[model samples]
Target: MVANPARRAAVTDAALELLGREGARAVTHRAVDAEARVPTGTCANYFRSRSDLLAGIAQRIFVLLAPNPDRLDELAELPVDDAGPAYAGYALERLLAHPNLARALVELRLEAPRSPEVAQPLTEFLRAGFDMDVEFHAARGLPGGREHVLRLHHLVNGIVLDALTIPLAPDIDPVTQAKDTARALGR
Candidate 1:
């Protein structure tokens, strides 16, 4: 049978917290085990390799992104001035929910230079996210097709990247920032 889901979840949450708080270099198995309050070797027992742990963390992050289907749908429904701001707002909320997962996401991109297996999933995730945004934008009155979609996609990606990595005032509102950014971009 698979490992205990609760224990696994606890460990995953701890890992993400560590990732967000400590950066990628700090996500050690021992640290995760300690953070999860699991005994030594517990993390290793569940995730035998660093890559496996990272992949599992990714899975957990996707789950964390949407704990409830209704909430996920609601996330998709939040009105924005344009597609770029929508992406930014979503990205901000998702990132803020678990800073560690956000940090891991950025770290994963950096790791692309070292390995393809890790990069592949990140690439697919990005593409799928952009595709969803395309549909959302089209639904909201954007007339252009693929080319226009790419333009908005890239713009949002830049916003998300900056928002995640760049330090901002604690009170910065993602929706407001995204709206301003989109407007500045002439969206």
Candidate 2:
């Protein structure tokens, strides 16, 4: 059995890489085992079923994609009206830079509705992200409150989705889109 947390993370990382590089169908336990360079049956030992593996992958996605704590702290201390655009544009730029992460997340989200195992992980990820947004806005006494945070969450998801799948016109800038969305949040 896979007893080490590092080994489990490695297996999940391999599964995430497979999901990004191939698709959901390519992330079987044996494939992850081979990709992770662990012993055969290692992934199976760690994850009892396909759904468990998928859930593990979902968890890994958040670990890889979540913002840096330092950056979050800095943003939390800044005036929202003055710093909101900067934060939004920075976030969009980071998202644009990590297309693979976005693809893996989008893939998991697509799979979540049909797979009960993924649903909890996906919901947890969203909740955590939403909570962070709420804290960030509340820390700065920003208006628009929880509803605005939810709207921004949906907007970010849509922008990330477009960044992953749809090719855009040269002039359709993600940074601009983010800034516009932030502005709509009523400062």
Candidate 3:
């Protein structure tokens, strides 16, 4: 496989855009090449198959969504009671800021169950992230433990899904809701 980091990122980013805008079916190698403005077979060079392409996108989504370490340090300094909501709000804000990445993640999640190739890597990456969240929560002495973090994950996923699709509470601010929900869960 090629080792051009910039080109690889471009290919995966193009795939993400296609997944976000046109759904998973539109994310072919040729289509990605066109979207990335690269020559033909460029995406295929980075990802040999459709499963590879989807898995690569899944990896890229997490990379793009990862919280800033510096910000995490700042949040860690907050009072224990306040930190949870602050972190939750910050996370939601970051996720909402990249609408395309969020949509692509949703599409990849939907595809995971049916495609083992996508499911394996996606599940691994998700589990790793969940574990890190649990560790962070524990280290920060946040309001709850692993279960609380899991609940927060469910809440955030619901909120993001609603935001992306038919919003149930369109009038309510998602970031506020996230912070409030985190506070409630902590209690």
Q: Residue 80, candidate 3: how far off, in angstroms?
A: 0.8
1 or 2, greater by TM-score: 2
Pairs with steric clashes in candidate 2: none
Candidate 3 per-residue C-alpha lDDT over 61-147 given as tens digits, one digit per residue, 9 for 90 to 100: 898899999998998899999899898888888888888888888899999999998999899999999999999889888867899
TM-score for each predicted model, relative to the true structure? 0.73, 0.88, 0.96
Judging by lDDT, tell me the better candidate of 1 and 3.
3
Compare the candidates by TM-score and give the number of the best one.
Answer: 3
Stretches off by above 4 angstroms in model 1 are 67-87, 140-153, 160-174, 184-187
Lowest summed lDDT over 10 consecutive residues: which window, candidate 1? 79-88
Taken over the whole model, the C-alpha lDDT of each candidate is 0.67, 0.81, 0.91
Predicted candidate 1: what Cα RMSD to the true structure?
3.6
lDDT of 2 by residue, 33-52 (tens): 99999889999998999999
lDDT over C-alpha atoms for residue 171 of model 3? 97
